[model samples]
Target: MQLITWNTQWCRGLDGVVSAQRIVDGARAMADFDVLCLQEIAQGFDNMPGAPGDQPAELAALLPGFQVFFGAAVDEFDAQGKRQRFGNLIATRLPVARLQHHPLPWPSDPSVFSMPRMCTVVTVRDPVLGPVRIMTTHLEYYSQTQRLAQVHALRELNAEACAQAAAPPKAETEPSPFQPKLHTPHAIVCGDFNLTVSRPEALVSAPEYQAIHRAHAHGRLQDAWPLAHGDTPHAPTFRLFDRTYGPDPVTADFVFVSDSLAPRVQRVEVDLQSRASDHQPVLIAL
Candidate 1:
């Protein structure tokens, strides 16, 4: 299976053009990805830069034969009284058994501006791997306090999934909403984590990132990059040669796979030439 993750920046390119078709074109040029994960998709928000249209719907329409799931972290009424949303998206050609939207921690931090973040979890039935969880999220970019809390929340969610996988609830004879949904501990968590920084002294090097890596060592999750590339330095996925955001390039996107699927990792790569969005797309093949 091939999966691609990118932060579309509301489908705005470096040329300041917002085209959902362009986003789809860029991903297709990268690979025939079975799963596509996107962040910063806007819907019914015309005030944004470059006039992003109904991106969530547009993208879904553009990708035929794929199951599209949108998790809106920010939902509010626009000036025209229409509901507008901004968040992440997951589209897959595989069969999805279950779906859930998890709102990340967003405690108030008056000192810095922030917004609610979310993780979209989808359990897809892979022909080779069977039921596998695929989670994509965009973390809080402005506030470290909130980002740390969100990271912990993600860890807790992973633990919960693992626990459930170990002992799933008994299925009743009657079909109801109370019935447990199909899920798997084997997962692939990917997206723009917003953990890298341009400045050397920034709070991007916080211990929370290390804690996540430690979980991998404890046989829970592992970075797919290392599993595929060994100790090679990660390719820059954001702000690379794009002075509009920052002078220094850094990697803010990643793909983390459960230890159970780590060995299935065949290749991990970043598209260095595409300018479909401010960030590059990270592709992983299993």
Candidate 2:
């Protein structure tokens, strides 16, 4: 199975043009993927950069034969009284058995600007892997306090899933909303994590990276980059060579999987040439 994760910056390109069709075209040019995870999609907000757009509807209309699921972290009524939403999306060609939306920690941090964050989780039936849980999210970029809290929340959520998989709930009667759904320990968490290690002097440092590795060592989760390219530095997924957004490039996006699925990681790559968004697309093949 091939999966792609990208932060579409609301489908705006370096040339200051916002086109949802171009975003789809660029992703398809990168790889023939079974699953597509996107972040920073806007809806019914005319004030955003280029123009007002319903990105979710536009993308769904553009991609035929794909199940589109959107989880909005920011949902409110605009001045025109239309529903405005901004968040992550997961579109897949595979069969989805279950779906859940998790709102991440958004405690008030007046020290810096921030926004509400969320994760979109989907349980899909892969042709080879059977039941697989895939989640995508974008963390708070401006506030480290909020970002760390959100990270802890993600870890807790994973632990909860693992616990549930080990001891599932009893089956309920048919036609009930409380019916037990498929839950798996195997999962893939991918998106613009807003994590950076380049400037240990200012922002995050080695401890953050160590925490993630420790989780992997305990047989909970593992980073896909090392599994594909051992000991190599991660490729830049944000900023990179795009000066339109700034010259200081850093790696913020990632694809992480459960340790059990590490061996199935065939390839992981970043599309360096695409300019459909400020961030580059990361693809992983299993």
Candidate 3:
């Protein structure tokens, strides 16, 4: 399976371009990405300039064959008295089995007022891979404190969801010995984590990686990047070669996996060349 994660910056390209067609075209050119995780998708949010009336719908229209799920981190009334959304989105070509919305903790910064961050979970049945879970999220970018808390919340949420699914169904009826039992499904955590694995406090296996590690330890989620590229020069997923930003930047987009699904991790690539969005899309294959 091929998966891509990008922060679309409300589908507004660098300089004054705001075209969903261009974004979709760029994504299609990369590869037939089975799942696409998009962050910063604006939908009638406060009547901002270049804001689409309905971004998710527009993207769905652009990719006719795909099923889409949008999780609104913030929903407020627009000037026209209609509800508007600002949040994360996932588009997939496979049959959707489940969809969930998980809200992340908001920051306390007084000056950095913005919409809340959230994670959208999409479960689909891949033709060759059976059942798979795709979780896409954009975390708090400003405050490290808030981001750390959000990470912990995410780990606990995932564990709870997975555990509930694994539990046997409650029923008074007798079970059939010939019936097949399903195992706990695998999950793909892809998004702009904002917290990099290079940071000791963000790693799942490290002592100071924070409570998120503890939560995932029970859930069995593992970092897929280090597993695939282990200390390689995959730095700089952002600020693409523009001399104005800085000499070097850091990577914030990530693709993580459940410990049970690590064996199926085929490859992970940080596509630094794509200018579909301000942030580069991280592609992962299984």
Residue-level lDDT tens digits of model 1 in 23-80: 8998998899899999999987888898787887898889999989999999999667
Candidate 1, TM-score vs. the true structure? Answer: 0.94
lDDT of 3 by residue, 1-286 (tens): 8988888878876664677787777777777898988988878763576656688889999888899888999888856788888899999998887788988887677766455888898888888888787888888766667777777777877787677667845544556653443434578887887654444333444322445445453476666777787766554566664434445455677787887678888888776676656778788888
Q: Report clash pairs, candidate 2.
A: none
Residue 171 deviation, candidate 3, in Å?
5.5
For candidate 2, write residues 1-286 as lDDT tens digits. Answer: 8999999999999888999999899889878889999999999887889984899999999889999999999999967788889999999999999999999999889988798999999899998988888989999888878887887777777778877887889978796987987878888989998876555233225544445555531237778988998867788888775755455777889898987788999999999888888899999999
Query: Clash number for model 3?
Result: 0
TM-score (C-alpha, index-matched) for candidate 2:
0.93
Q: What's the residue-level lDDT of 98 in candidate 2?
A: 93
> Against the unseen true structure, what C-alpha lDDT does each candidate score?
0.86, 0.85, 0.75
Worst 10 residues of 3 by lDDT: 200-209
Q: Rank the candidates by lDDT, best first.
A: 1, 2, 3
- After superposition, the stretches of candidate 1 with alpha carbons farther than 4 Å from their true spots are 197-205, 216-219
